[model samples]
Target: MDKSVSKSSQPSGGNGFPTSSSNGRKLNKKLVYLCSIVMAVLFFLGIAAFVFLFLLHKNPKATNKNIASFRVDSIFVSRFKLSSSKITASWDIRLSVQNPSTASVSYQTFYTWIQYKQERLSNVTNIAPFQVRGNNWTAENGKLVAKSVRADEKVIEDMATEMANGSVNFNIGLYAGFWIGNEEAKRVWRAVEAHCSDLKIGFSSKDNMGKLIGEPIECILTKTW
Candidate 1:
């Protein structure tokens, strides 16, 4: 009788192949954990940005009401002299400024001039800087003196007409450096212009004094730069 040989079957790399599959599973789990951590960081950053924008919209630095509060309180043309050759005049102006915000408002190096029919009649006079406290009002004064301004035939005619009418309308121009906050060093200065369309004054050919005709009129203020 012939003896039969028994055959045994076995897999290649016996248990090592199964160990490699286990390692692959562990690597996949690690990758998923890293992705989750990155997504969480992005979510927090987005939340922070949204909160900052919401707060900024709720509170603004300057408002229309606050800017509109600035006005010319009074104006006095104390003396106005007219001659065949030249014209001379002096005037006093007062400004009422109000600040409605929490920060202090400051005005500096202000200069003012008088105009008639878009013609500049006098030189600019410098006024000192002034500050208005938060939620408060402040009065500032300005003075102008025009001397020996050469008068033309048209100017004389205009003067006569105004004197006869008993009321002369003049425009006032103003330029100032301003800052809105308490930290003045960090604040930027800007130019301002004021126009007084309702200014009324009485001119007499015999007397040098020109009387104010009516109540103080409000001036329109605008930013130049």
Candidate 2:
């Protein structure tokens, strides 16, 4: 009886192999937890990237440099009335210009009358200083400048006389894109570099409820005459 030993109770493998049901269950649970952790990490990374991109889009000041083109719309001379005075010569011209961009913008316009024989320009009538608005437009800030071809009366007077005598065919700029090359316009142009800039003509339309309404800055025609 003393020599009897229990062989059935002894371990089957020499190494500590996980043969118990509890050990197997624990291994499966650990494997599942590892997989879940990896999946969560990947999902979090995707969400982070999406949020970053969305914020970039929402930035107001950030602009797309590669915007293919700036456009002008609904442009018309609208009306023209010539006025004569002993004091000075001035033309009352009304023009409507529009900026077609969804983003806010600023721009300028520049032009001069042609010195025709009978319509010989002794000087630029109704001369006005350059102005800009709507999108922070300014003439002083542009690296490239907008210039008038024949704004001075004396220089243009000689050219006008030459035209009247049939010595020169005097053609002056009547309409142009910029009218003049200036700052806000070069970065964002509705037309040429030399266009009139400093004029305030805009409109805001609202609904009947006194709520916010559509506000489109249209070029207002002042009494040019």
Candidate 3:
């Protein structure tokens, strides 16, 4: 009798393709992960861009507009009642101003050797730049303060100590107003006005150097308690 033959079944290997489908599936999974990572990055970038654009559109200050303004909120002249202190006028003043535009505004503020009742006082120099706009204090409309006299015993101080303590005994008015422009003549006027001996006089801005007022503007100065 002839011997019977048997064969075992097994995967083919000579073509180098029996495990290719599994390898291809692994590759697809890696690609999916890579795509997911790329999508995440793009999503974050898109969100950041959207936020930036939203702020730019919703806020005018963030937009393009560069015209600032300022004001003399309050003024305090110490010793008005007692008139003590032979500098018969050692004083501290308070002024509030604003920047209503987009860019920063700058100007020099010189102490006007006040020639009031025939007395030569000390001169003060203030070459400081005021920048409280869209970058800071935007909600309050770019408002800032100068607490020290341009030419006083103190360069600048958070004044009104007497007023805060109900100890001030003087009465006087310190009025002020000005405008900054994008012109040479206006720049000249900034210097001229800063050196003028009349900031304590009146707020008649209509009679200034020119009929043009640009960057900064203030309301009529008034005396207040």
Candidate 4:
């Protein structure tokens, strides 16, 4: 006799549509493959970030260009006399301030001091507000004077001895704030401090006028914030 197939005699997943268990297997495989792809992408991105940071660290000059430079061009002492109990002097200072960065810099009021044998002297003038463009420089002038000011006995003696030797050493300190900006707008101000040390001013007995000796003194720049 001719046999007939029943619905229950066929395979459980023999229909055009897969069974529930077969669908579950395919879905799990797709989820696993998606997760692997995501992980691979993340790993490559992390490697790229690491390489970029390493390159930046290796090349620091790219960021150092924002800083400026300062130098003491000349210092003239028109009069300087040290007595047993007092001191008297007149100093004219010239500074060359250069903006080596790509941005323009606007300076605030500058505070400058002169020191002899570590003793600060009285000053009359300060550097006024100014601005400089990229790769530009400016000459700043200041005056310091001491008119029969009382001095320490030790300092007076030391200064007198040094002056007789034809040269005297002094230190120059500068403190100020500056704003850095592009063409669009300006940013906040940053404080800076500079120190130019071991400045030698040589004097002649004939004229008694002292002038800076040797090469131009470069100031040590420090950023306060």
How do the predictions measure up, each by TM-score? 0.66, 0.30, 0.27, 0.69
lDDT of candidate 2 over 69-154, digit per residue (tens): 22222111111112221112222233333322334443234343423333333343322334433333332211111122234445
Measured over all alpha carbons after superposition, the RMSD of each candidate to the real structure, in angstroms, is 9.3, 16.5, 16.4, 7.9
Tens-digit lDDT string for candidate 4 (1-225): 224356566557776567899889999999999999999999999999999888766532235434667899999987777778887888889998887755678887678878876777666356889998867999888887878878789988887788889998998888877777754353556677888999999999887689999999999976555
Alpha carbon lDDT at 114, candidate 1: 83
Per lDDT, what order, best first? Answer: 4, 1, 3, 2
Candidate 4 worst ten-residue window by lDDT: 57-66
* Pairs in steric clash, model 3: 67-101, 68-100, 70-98, 80-170, 81-169, 81-170, 124-151
What pairs collide in candidate 1? Answer: none
- Which parts of model 4 are misplaced by more than 4 Å? 1-66, 182-185
Q: Candidate 4, after superposition: displacement of residue 82 in Å?
A: 1.2
What is candidate 3's lDDT per residue for 115-192, written digit by digit as tens? Answer: 232333333323243434333332111111222213232311111233233332222222222234344463212222
Clashes of 2: 27
Number of the top-ranking candidate, with lDDT as the measure:
4
> Worst ten-residue run, lDDT, model 2?
204-213
Q: Relative to the true structure, how large is the alpha-carbon lDDT of every model?
A: 0.71, 0.35, 0.35, 0.79
Kindly report which residue stretches of model 3 are placed more than 4 angstroms away from their true locations once superposed. Answer: 1-9, 14-18, 60-225
